[model samples]
Target: MYKIYNTILDFSDYLKYDFLSLSDKPVTQTPTSISIQFHQKPESNFVWIDSRDYPGLFASGYSNDPTELWKCLNDAILSYFGVPRYEAKKRGLPYSLPLPNGQAIVQQDAQKYAGA
Candidate 1:
């Protein structure tokens, strides 16, 4: 299995390629051995792998170890494309793989009313 982070949507075209052409199913279908191809829908920022009909393997992100997931996916992409890790680092090819992170603001109380 191979994983590609697809930060700047560079590998978006590959997503349309047949990843399971050679084999009926992925050689290995574990969290660490599954392949990932991330691509955003038109006019969208989220990339999703719809494993609805897929059997054998899938890709998922970990909430606790987001950094590791990014690193691993980037590495896999570089390797699959036969690009040197150092060159990619120097060129900043990975672009920007955004993690599902954000903050929620809450209003504890409304403005205090004047003393009555």
Candidate 2:
């Protein structure tokens, strides 16, 4: 599972990519990872993950301990890609490959939300 904490994704093409891709369906990939960067409000515990390539798409975390905010970003992306919240939480996001012909694997991993 990949954590989208302080890394900024340069691939604006997947600006719609969701941290929602953190999953446990089969645990197999090409061993690739994306770097993440984020922004935090100066006065509060508000944090956000925005992308230059993914304009209008962003993920934020605001909980006191601050681990579930990224989940919101995943929700936004799944919804953008037409996945409902209930279903996503239940079975996790679907697996897919990337790029112009690829899809972001944003899954709401239970462990991630559990703050593992």
Candidate 3:
């Protein structure tokens, strides 16, 4: 379980860093509004705690089985970067501010987790 928890911590840290960077973007189009966009379908990629229509990846029986560590890892990745439950259910892509360096930070993190 230590590996699982470590993975979660690392993923959470990456997300927090990425989101904070995203929040720092300068607003342009709408002075009082903030807009974010994503390249993938959030629902198909990740699961949020509040999601209803699609049960979370972990909610599936496979995720809970100790033998299915890969499933847990996949679920964690989805939960970390996928769209929030309310929005994902509406077919919304996950929203994050684009990083100034144009780096795909989330994808990198996912890869790191997978490779580990």
Clash totals, every prediction: 0, 16, 0
Q: Can you list the residue pairs that collide in candidate 1?
A: none
Per-residue lDDT tens digits of candidate 1, residues 1-116? 13355433434433422342332332322232233345445664434432233342223344455444455554454454455432344333242344445431111111211112
Which regions of candidate 3 deviate over 4 angstroms?
A: 22-116
TM-score-wise, the better of 1 and 2 is: 2
Candidate 2 lands at a TM-score of: 0.41
Candidate 2 CA-lDDT value: 0.45
In candidate 3, list every pair of residues with a backbone clash: none
User: lDDT value for candidate 3?
Assistant: 0.34
- In model 1, how many backbone clashes occur? 0
Best by lDDT: 2
Best by TM-score: 2
C-alpha lDDT (0 to 100) for residue 68 of candidate 1: 49
RMSD of each: 20.0, 15.2, 16.9
TM per candidate comes to: 0.31, 0.41, 0.19
For candidate 1, which ten residues in a row score worst on lDDT? 105-114
Report the backbone clash tally of model 3. Answer: 0
**Per-residue accuracy of model 2 over 1-116 as CA lDDT, tens digit each:** 14443123323212333444543344222212223346778988777765465456566766353335545655555554555333444334332212222434354455554455
- Candidate 1 yields a Cα-based lDDT of 0.37
